[model samples]
Target: MSNLKPEPANAPDDPLRRTLLKGAGILAAGSLAGSALGLAPAARAETSAGLGGRLRGVQHFGITVQNMDRAFEFYTEVLGGTEVMRDGDFFGDRIQNTLLLTEEVRAVRDGVNPVTLGIPDLRSGAQRLDVRFIQFDNVVIELLQYRDKEQPTGSGKAFAPAQDLTSPAFPRAMHVCFYIRDDVDFNQFVRDLEAESARRGMSNVKANRIVRATTDEQRLGASLDSNTNRITEGPSAGWSLIYCKGPEGEQLEFVQVQGHAKQVFDGAYESRRKQLGA
Candidate 1:
């Protein structure tokens, strides 16, 4: 999805936050919210404190969504994400899938939308993000949307290139990524994406690119002060990343190359956790 400023530890919860968290990327609140949200640390501390072994692999990813209901419907009923954790939206006063750990959305979404409309109007549902969230499976996936966003950006705009193939379902500058297990099927999955996009008249879906990252870029990532994107530069040696965009100028990132993604995470997470001493 998108990333925003880190949440303050003392920042009290608010209703308007629902809009802010949607597509804000840096969600530090709500279900599954990370350190960005106060509860994540508590979850980690609760788990870590009790005692558990390191994970063999990532179990799930956390992301923001616009229409929690529609997303839930699409994911659970359509994609088959077993309901994990869900609750009410503090702001909208509506029921939402605050937390849903799914494995299906990761395998589809982009590919399916394209098939529904081949070379379709890039503006259609492209940027209309009704829902967004993370998925769980053999691999982890993150889905994002623009239609349901009500979050205040202080002042920011989506950037879309003029000549990029226009899409009605997924716009430019908007992006979400799926983290594939090292052994996850690659070719077969691409075929699935292609087939779905083609079926929907969105043959243009094949135009999308699949990128593989390197661990070197992950370590080389620039500091938090990196740039306007708040993106860190790759370490020049250990890791790197891949970037893609959907319709309406949403940016998607495949972060920290496989081998090196954890380098910085280890240092940063450890340091932050120690700082909190939680």
Candidate 2:
């Protein structure tokens, strides 16, 4: 998945942050690394009270869908995500009320296009939303079905280039990723993704390799290491990432950090729990 920012130019030289960066790759997978690292020292300086810090870690990913049952089948039957919690009515009152609170929603209701504000196509008529929360390993996935409204129709194709690791967009949140355990059959997982995409008639489900683990210098537009930025140091040394598109055009990443799960998946989890006294 996307929604991650590049590393900052001026991050403090805290030993703890350095250590965490080595293990957690500067920030969590879907985090704004630059912003997080930039504000970390300031957060520390201003907040010494209990449980006071920048965000601990990611909790879940949310997405709006057109069909609840179809999306549920793809996530549950295909990806094997376990259902955790779900509560919503097909009427969409709660969801519409929540959306109406946002400036983008208001602008759309005024019959103005909102693509620049990241709110594309104002849907007319009743807006309905039902939700399904699923857990894939440690990450929680939220699937929302928003319907009964007029939305710009599409050919149901995803065209964004996959090579752009950072999918720079208006609402920068681009994708959701899942960790592939060291013991899992990697080939089978890839096959499964391909099969699911084919089943849904989406041709965008192809795998792309992340040749290098991102570095702060790289974030500044430095040339990649001649060796192709292969993981040579840190917890993810020698690791690789592969990604694909889901049925409804959502980017899905499956990371393979050989020998162990990335600290972002396992370690950051503990850190967040400790931060929350869980």
Candidate 3:
């Protein structure tokens, strides 16, 4: 039997309605984590009030992809994500207005094809989007594919290629970090990642050597000064991390905390939990 299921109906046209729905999903996931961490209900309420009821936990992170199939394989097969949902046919007035994509739509209507801008000549309505949701443990990732209606078999329009994220230092660059569980062998995990990438011939994916932080200064310096030097005697003695690039050149990080570092983390969490009161 086919495992594919029908897509859910389009979300309501109201922007606020969509925001609330998205917020609900984030809250549902955040509540479980908060409860497990022993966050006090009253304190949580007060914190929200203090923030003017604006900020909440992240709902999901999205990445635009050129090839949905390739991105799906890299995320699911390589990174061990599970497909949660897939939806398409995202075009027309609702998308244009809601996403403020009217400029692109208007340009298309005025005969300003993508080819005129030196980009690929995508099929008509190339601004339309296809989305796939994948979940990795607690985090959800949304992979977006901008597509358009199919053209004739020999139509000049071609699939766009993935763009390189030249450097993390570039403006507006962003990366996602995944925390490795304490029980997982950090070295072996990286090795397995490399092996899988090799097996799949994912040439664009690359990883740096794992860096171990031996001192609290080194840990802090890694972020502030980009220092990777080792030092003796500090709380972060066993913290290890590695930076990598995904198939689309997106930056990623994996970290494993151990030794004194794990103790420090546990203590901090417990202290916060207690401060919140139960």
lDDT of 1 by residue, 140-238 (tens): 334333231233221122222233543435543234554433453443344443355345443223212333225424422433222112123555333
User: Which segments of candidate 2 are over 4 A away from where they belong?
Assistant: 1-57, 90-97, 104-125, 149-171, 200-204, 209-235, 259-278
Q: Single out the weakest 10-residue window by summed lDDT for candidate 3.
A: 1-10
TM agreement with the true structure for every prediction: 0.35, 0.53, 0.65
- How good is model 2 by TM-score? 0.53
Q: TM-score of model 1 relative to the true fold?
A: 0.35
lDDT tens string, model 2, 151-247? 2211221112223343425376577766666676665566656666667765545544334436533422433222122354776775655566566
- Winner of 1 and 3 under TM-score: 3
- The per-prediction CA RMSD against the true structure, in angstroms, equals 16.6, 14.6, 8.2
Identify the leading candidate in terms of lDDT: 3
Clashes of each: 67, 3, 0
Decreasing lDDT order of the candidates: 3, 2, 1
**Best candidate per TM-score, number?**
3
